[model samples]
Target: MIFCTYTSLVSVTHTTVVDAPILEVYSSLYQKYGTKLTCPCTNIAIAQRDFITLIPTFHQVCYSDFVKKSWLSYLNAASDKYLSSDFRSQGGLLFQILASFCRLSQDTIKNSLNKFYSTRFISNDVLDEDLLKNQSRSHIETYKSTTAREFVNSFNNIRDAISGNQLLSGFLTNFDFKPSKYSSEPQAYLVSYVSTVYNMPGRCNCDDTPSCIFPASINDNNTGHVILVVPGLYTGCLLVEAMRQSNLQCLYNQTCLNEIKKHIRSSVSFNSTALSSFVPSRYNASTDINQLLTELMVESWIENISHASYYNRCQPAHCVYTIVGKNNAIYIITALLSLLGGLCKVLYFLTLIVVKIIRRRRGKIVSIKFLVGMSEIYSILTL
Candidate 1:
């Protein structure tokens, strides 16, 4: 027993606080402590901008001449242009929708930023950089996914009402049809109205759905009943539908741009520059406008996050942890002496109890033997 030494474990805690720039603090704490260290934050509420940065790269169509007023108005004023999908009569509406889409996409993203910032964030800890990034990414993706789904439903409603119902036809009912500078005959105005508004003659009259409106060329206003399907551009029941399905793939080629440039009323030469699909974008040149709209017309989204910023915002008061430690020589010696004292008291009590029990049993045996001897002596005396 003298050769052996008594050992005991003592729990000890070490705490340290580093004062540095946000990025440096995060790097140092993460590298040194791994997960063993923790610091409770003095302030937990942090602005989202401190931890998250997101930038959306919009599609080239939004910036191209297609959406610009100069190009659209030029196409609209072309006297020789007869294709409605060429941005002639409905150019204003097309421009309106495109402009609205661009503005609304940005506004929605702004709202998302503000809304996310409004929420509370604990940061959990300073070293939880991965956790913070994942949260921000998830938040952005959720907004994008929700916006895409909602846009699809809303656009479908508009398309359905324009083609299958009389929802939009009522707006033109009160307007007087008159002769335009393009044509002296007021009847030409009527023909244009039916073609542009109803998409086809008698298309305005519908309980559930009107007749299908195919693309047509307006060589002469007198031929209202005739349907002409124009080549090189798409046209359907509504111009909006055509635009949604359209892409600038043709403008990429020299020949296609040349043919289309014939109708453009620009005095200057219109470049055949195409929308670039080579950039790091989720969509390609031939991707439909509707598909692009699903992504808010954003070619790409870039996110930048810094854990140092998060740690600074957290501003932990202290780092707290426990360490497994062996007792010192003095403490071990004291504990060993106390253990020996307790063991001695316990053994003494046990020995006293055994002796007492043995004495009581021996007295009982002697009493029984004495009673038997007395009985035997009485029986012998009587004999």
Candidate 2:
């Protein structure tokens, strides 16, 4: 069995409750500010950017507003209860109220910047840059990476819930507040949700173990169902945005490709027989007729004199027809001398025949045996 210990760490469960009704809050965030307006950070309008940014800002702003309103109201409610009744009687309740106040205060501050990003006359780009810096600073101050991530994650959750209506349905419980069946399932990033939240950067790797098992929810609403609905989209668009930046493409491809190259390099091996089949050539001065003929018989170059093989291999063929060597010159001289000797023998035979014919015409008897002897001598001369 392949035990996946890392898989256990994925899809972290988080729950938070706002004082307002969940549907009303969801609608206020999603419906009201979903339209593209002028950016708070820049002079350019929201229409110039992408549609994904538009809706998420809605959720961010709404959540931020909710944080402020809910926490204050919760505090006021606690104050009235404590002041109206005896403090001694309600001291235990006071602790609970104070604890709620602390939790909501932190949540409110986080939400405030996010809300501001979606609103008013400033540039979205500046707001985003500021938010990242703020988050980083907060992370340093708190010395808690997980909480720091949560601060951004909450806003990201809202982004996902809006982009994937199915995800919103899964994350948000019915008015009766029944836990969804998938609530126990792990949290993973959603492609469309992440695209909307992060401007369609790199893809989500939901199957990645351990990190995938965390329970996903928006504002800690419907954990499991929400993850299943939207996949890997994180809050704040930080991870996706970083990946989309041009400088990191090489690193991104390298990380994924290195594994394949490693397996190939490891499996390869050299074979001695394959190497031994090829040998380097050495020049030979001595020429043996038998060896030359044997080599010519088997050699592809000699057989492919018309250079058919050169075309097959996509090369230009230019054969050298001249032979230059001491022994080669001797053979050429011998052939030339032999041709002259044969011509001389033929001329001497013709002269002798004419002389015999002339003598026979003058009434002298010609000797057939003598003629035959002369013919044999000419043949020898020809050789």
Candidate 3:
């Protein structure tokens, strides 16, 4: 399960148009939460702990938006200069972006796996095999084969549990807050924030028109539901502004545009239905902010867990080292020592056997007392 922990701005904006004023909600949030709500990485030490703990799950992890953005910027720069970027072509671009960015972070990618997952879950043998791989793709896939798929499958079960009518009943009883406690507003401005650090080719702009040309088969009904989830209020406004700034007025030829409109209408219809399911509650911005924080925290936790698991499986360099790091180093030394010790023992035994055979060949009467005395002497010499 890809647990995305984007800024809470995405969720807040994605709702249908609310009956209450938008500023009211914003005011409530700032008053109650304000800057107090920051990324959980506020404390460097805690962040490190979280990083170490979650390293095993993400084979291909990107810790900072800065790194992913840098790669994206480089790809775009190459494209603008008509130069062969790290990704030679459109296909290459997608693969590189996914390999480099995606879920796994750079810091985690750099460290040894054994250190992250702990020795209990991994061993020396596995670490050696993992570090042997050169490319990021192999590392990512290996991790998935080991970790991601299983965790996602389990998360699916949790999601399924919350899907049916049993969700509200159980949620209300167990949790401190409920979605129903919010304002009785019928509409939410539904927005969806796609990851901004996109390195895909042919993705020059996010204009509604450019979206029409995307190669992914667009369901005629699905086209209109393209809710752009921006990272922040400023970003959202910038997105719309960029659409206007870019002379990309003609969305994917006229035919694609028509299809896109159809998709948008269908999406609106779907959102209307989805929005209707939950009972509306009285609006209290502070309460809503709290709820949003809760949702973000849960998402961050899940993403961290799933990503760490994937890393362990992916063995993206650092992950493999985390496992066998100290133990593997020690194991190699131990093996050498054992081999040497065994060799000495074997040599001592061979020496004794040779001495006895020589005495026998000399026709000497090898009495039991003589043999016993010889054996004792050999043992002392060997020790």
Model 2, position 206: C-alpha lDDT score: 29
Q: What tens-digit string does per-residue lDDT give for candidate 3 at 90-175?
A: 21243243343233333333353443334233222221222323323343345434443443344345434543322222112111
**Which model, 2 or 3, shows the larger lDDT?**
3
Full-model lDDT, candidate 2? 0.30
Model 1 agreement with the true structure over 1-383: per-residue lDDT tens digits: 54124364545454556543355555566666667656667676777777777788887767776666666556455543333333334444544556677777777777876776665665555556776778777876886798677766777887676654444332232122354446455433433233333434345433334233334232334554433323324444444555566555664455555555554455444355555556566666567677777887787878887777677778876665444466677777787889889989999999999999999999999999999999999999999
Question: RMSDs, each prediction?
Answer: 9.4, 40.2, 31.8
The candidate scoring highest on TM-score is 1
**Candidate 2, 191-297: lDDT as tens digits:** 33222221233443322210111211122122422212112212222222211111111112333223222222222221111111122212121222122222211
Q: What's the lDDT for residue 168 in model 3?
A: 29
Error of 1 at 371 (Å): 39
**C-alpha TM-score for every candidate:** 0.63, 0.17, 0.17
Give the least accurate 10-residue stretch of model 2, judged by summed lDDT. Answer: 297-306
Candidate 1 or 2, higher TM-score?
Answer: 1
